[model samples]
Target: MDRKQHIAIFTTASLPWMTGTAVNPLFRAAYLAKNGERKITLVIPWLSLKDQKLVYPNNTTFGSPSEQESYIRQWLDQRIAFISGFTIRFYPGKFAVDKRSILPVGDISEIILDEEADIAVLEEPEHLTWFHHGKRWKTKFRLVIGIIHTNYLEYDYPRSIVCNVHGVNTKFLEIGKKRFEQQHGSNQAFTKGDYYIGKMIWSKGYGELLKLLHDHQKELVGLEVDLYGNGEDSDQVKEAASKLKLTVRVHPGRDHADPLFHDYKVFLNPSTTDVVCTTTAEALAMGKIVVCANHPSKRLLQAVPTTGTEKLSSKKFASVSLNLWKTIEDTSAYVHHLALGFEATRRVFGAIPGSLQPDEEQRKELGLTS
Candidate 1:
């Protein structure tokens, strides 16, 4: 009989955050754990004070300072108290240690030492420090896998382990790609002209879309930009659009498959720091032209190839629609290629070897004495 493989996945972000970098890998990890017969543990950080305040404010029983600790402990305990059949256990940690700074009360190193996992996967850059500097778990875990969701990890990483990255979903990016394709039809047609869907944050680049509209005001006569979704920056977004003298409408939050996709002609993604946004892929899957204001990092440029996607331009904002059939053809190919890339990465983790080493150059660059 074969011994079950013990794997531990670490992330500084947890559910309800809505940030793709933290959420995507967790989703992928859950999918892998459920499908495999291995024992998996997910070590995640506690919600930050800011997020906690935003989520449970003055109106609730968690308002008082003295009661905050109890409430937090209660929340963490409840999160782990539930049992599931997937063979994956969630271990919430106190504070997270990153490269540049330490997250207050978010440490998970003790949990890592306790697990004695055969395989360890690090999702955040700071996780590498635990293995590299802590030394205890370096030899314990046979393989230490790393995942780089964006350019953040491209600059510096531990000399040890391979960090896979540079990768999307289609109509609604919030949901899984397979589910979206299964329910909405992968080759569905889109008739709507121009719209933006996602969080109203500065990083997502909603303001850039407004600028495009404001710049092309004369050409896009009678056309109004529709904004959907809510975030901490919602008021700022409204204020920016008002200053631009752009007509923008706010819609309540809804699922990705809401009829909105069919109501717009083109989809715009102006995100400044996205690795590869799900909304862009969804628009591609629906055969809609996606107008991107800024380019993604070089490592992730393949995921947002120029073939099916358009670079935002000052000249042709209003006259950039392509033929429906051609647009669909380009997007369909891109979607298929993206799906294959994701599956390949999943297989890499599922079949990792017992022991691994850092390349010679990597070690030399880091000047590791050990």
Candidate 2:
């Protein structure tokens, strides 16, 4: 919407860092590049080392502190610029996603101002607590709109911040009101994939989801839940699966897309932190039913309100309910919102916002009919 603004995406980690959170943004930038309008730049601490080179743009590079500020120095000491208006140097990594820590809010804010960003797509506010509350930043451009890919709200509810959802909760998948609009026209189920790929993390409800599969082993006759992605809890996940006696096949990697194509039935979204899962959207686009842990992030409460529970709430906006379709629509809106920004510059936006041909192509390559 603003004059073809320069966009810079800075990530604490690289693509597939942990399922949807890191992967989607890089894909979004790659998609924008197709339109050949707005300049897109990605500054991540580390770029994932996966086999598939075609899925993500070749342009993206990495410079971040991995072994404690070593990479951070590299990013800062060297001026990194990839695309026009899109630039990323380095920011101190002092906080986890939900954990509160203000490391380089001032420095990042300076970069946002220097670039004259129309919008700052912040990952986790705990990383930039200062800029999250800065009202004066609006004088520059749209403020930090946090991308809640986890489906569960992780923050203490920072004020004046809006978020985007990726998919339903961790256990169930339903069509969102907005997401179902196109599907209702056909009344057809979203395309089902044979296998799914994602990080096997705790909040993902992998244990319960495996129990459901193990209990419903008969129902899961032809289906196999495949998992890929790295985290600290991989062994625990394997242990749970073994305990549950799930017949899931797992191929683990950091940034690798499996060579085998799967007709995935359920895209496992286990994140309880944010609202949407990028891989969930990737799965949906691939035509799979996403079984997400709705409100996995919040503490269990007796009363289950819409988004997940009544306990969690954002600062200004009331936390919405987490359901199957709700997640899809929220994520779709975020993508579409980004698309509006990307398209405003001249690139042909995809049906899904902040996405491009690779989405369709990637899925098709995976043998997805949709």
Candidate 3:
């Protein structure tokens, strides 16, 4: 019989606070575990001042701080390291260290010492400080994987296992390619895009969008920029719009707000730090043109309106000329332009098996990450 390959998924977060890096690794690990191809263990820490479930796989109560220690203790007691949070099937795996005093390196190293894993993958290698301890873990895991999702990593990472691009936008890829070329020339690199775009955040920067609309309305009269989202940012958005003397409307959120683009000619993405920039995809998904800045995904759309040459460069702003062009120009043709791109990309990556909580669909429909 083939031995169950031991694998450790190291995360730098508590379950509840787990980000995409933390979540995606588990998804990949779960798929491998379900196939009986490997024994997968997820290591997370307790970061909450008050204990809570960091992330109980598949919505099962397994890894919350409240349930974590007891659950892990029980798993160790049973000599079981990995279990399918989706299928609840018992599989052999290990978990011991996390984001506490033990850095990502310490936690991963400790687990290797204890269980002597066969493979190791890290969510954020920036959190790992194991260069000196390389020999200690050299023969422990056959494969050591790392995820790099930011352009900054182009400078920080000595080498990358895989580049998980957040969205499949041509513009995003163009900038990434430029950044990569700047670093190592246009060489073949292992990279994938995570298309989780157009999320309706609670703080939908209506204020910023409103400010744009408000300031430009005189030159671009009666042009409505459809703002889609929910959250604390609602009032600020509305107030910003009010100050700009532009009309503001908030609609109910959707799992895939494709229908929202029907009447809207322009899409506005006013995010300051979210790298994925879902609206850039939503706009492309609907072929509704988007006004995004330095966003890698913006290139996939019809036009970028502006481009940035330097990091955080404000390459272009809403100029009187651009606003006039957008307000009167025919925008009806751009709405479905990005459709073909979205579908092709989805098919290739969707086959990568990953488990979502039983409640995930409902939560998505309800527009709550809770």
Candidate 4:
């Protein structure tokens, strides 16, 4: 019998916080542990209610460590199959309000010593203070791999890999679609308006979107958009939208797999800061036309057939909106083709050794022989 490979994943975020960093790493862990040939240990930060409140003042779903662990287990049980070898370990942590992240306060090397993992995968290692602080002990692990999920260009690791695109949990999305069909009837077609789902902050392109709509009201008179998310600027966005000539409704954030996402004809993501906007990928996977911003960070999205990246100017935004609204194609026809490609990407985590290859420079930096 082949010996099992023990993999340890150190992540900064987890369930009860639905950011892409939290959701994607958890899915990777579940997918890697599904076949029972590997032992998966997911190490997450444990913040007290006070620290969590300081960092995420708007959040209300946080609980004690035990409660949070239970929530994660129940979530995986509902979405994934054969998660028997998966384990969740929590380490003491504190909040860095300026960075908007939690830093592990305890010794992370202790977890490595206890777990005896053959490989250690760091999700967004640049954001993890422990990774930088414990460089002397990194050699304890047989292999260390870093997966960059943000747009911090200066960050470099020996085996660091940056993904321009990420995968979604299509199984959960399919289940949500079936549930929606059962409740609302299969005849429900796509709605005429566009929609956006993500954090409602100004840096997320709310200012640009509102400005474009307000500046070119005559060109986009009939256009309607629904914005779903919550942030410090939620009320401000709502007040601004109310003054626009076009119809714009601001709603609270919903789950990424909300079946209502399938009802929209187009998805709008004007943010240029994201390196690999997971929601935009999810929209394309759902067969919806996406109008995203054209920036070097978002170049990967241009490869998709149903996505258009436009300059962030008011004129360009107005022109793209008018052009895309001219025709709404059948979204259902493209769902299978696009979704299967994303599903295939998720399976790559199961074969990490073969999938991730470091260049010669990176290998030399880590003092590894090819």
User: Who wins the TM-score comparison?
Assistant: 4
TM-score of each: 0.57, 0.49, 0.44, 0.70
Task: After superposing candidate 3 on the true structure, give the runs of residues whose Cα lies further than 4 Å from its correct spot.
Answer: 13-19, 49-116, 128-140, 153-156, 161-211, 223-242, 248-291, 294-370
Rank by lDDT, descending? 4, 1, 2, 3
TM-score of 1: 0.57
lDDT per residue as tens, model 1, 1-370: 2666777776655444344544455545554565567766765444335334443223242233335434433433342323323322332222222121112121234455544558777765443332221233345577877665444534344233222342233224433344345448765344345777776566667767777778998887777677776566778888777765556776644434556555465777777555456666666655566777546432225442234245556445534543555567567545533432343442343311111232243234323232
**Model 2's TM-score against the true structure:** 0.49
RMSD of each: 17.2, 16.8, 21.3, 17.1
Candidate ranking under TM-score, highest first, comes to: 4, 1, 2, 3
Task: Tell me the tens digit of each residue's lDDT in model 4 across 158-273.
Answer: 33334453566676457445545654776644655698887777878999988988999999978999999866678899999999979999998887666666678688988876
* Segments in model 4 whose C-alpha atoms lie over 4 Å from true places: 1-3, 54-63, 81-84, 130-132, 135-137, 153-161, 172-188, 299-370
Residue 67 in candidate 2 has what lDDT? Answer: 36
Q: Residue-wise lDDT of candidate 3 within 1-370, one digit each (tens)?
A: 3666677766554322223443344455555665675667766543322122222223344423435545544433332235554211111111212312213211135544444467776655544432112333334567777654223422334333222334432433444344345447665332321112232343334445555566677887654444444332445544554554445555533323333333344456665434334455544554445565554323342322223323533436546546767554334223222221243532343311111111343233323345
* lDDT scores of the candidates, listed in order: 0.50, 0.44, 0.41, 0.66
Give the least accurate 10-residue stretch of model 4, judged by summed lDDT: 349-358
RMSD of 3: 21.3
Judged by lDDT relative to the true structure, which candidate is superior, 1 or 3?
1
Off by over 4 Å in 1: 48-50, 55-106, 112-116, 127-140, 152-191, 298-300, 303-370
Indicate whether candidate 2 or candidate 4 has the larger lDDT: 4
Sliding window of 10 residues with minimal summed lDDT for model 1: 97-106
Return whichever of 3 and 4 wins on lDDT.
4
Residue 14 local lDDT, model 3: 36
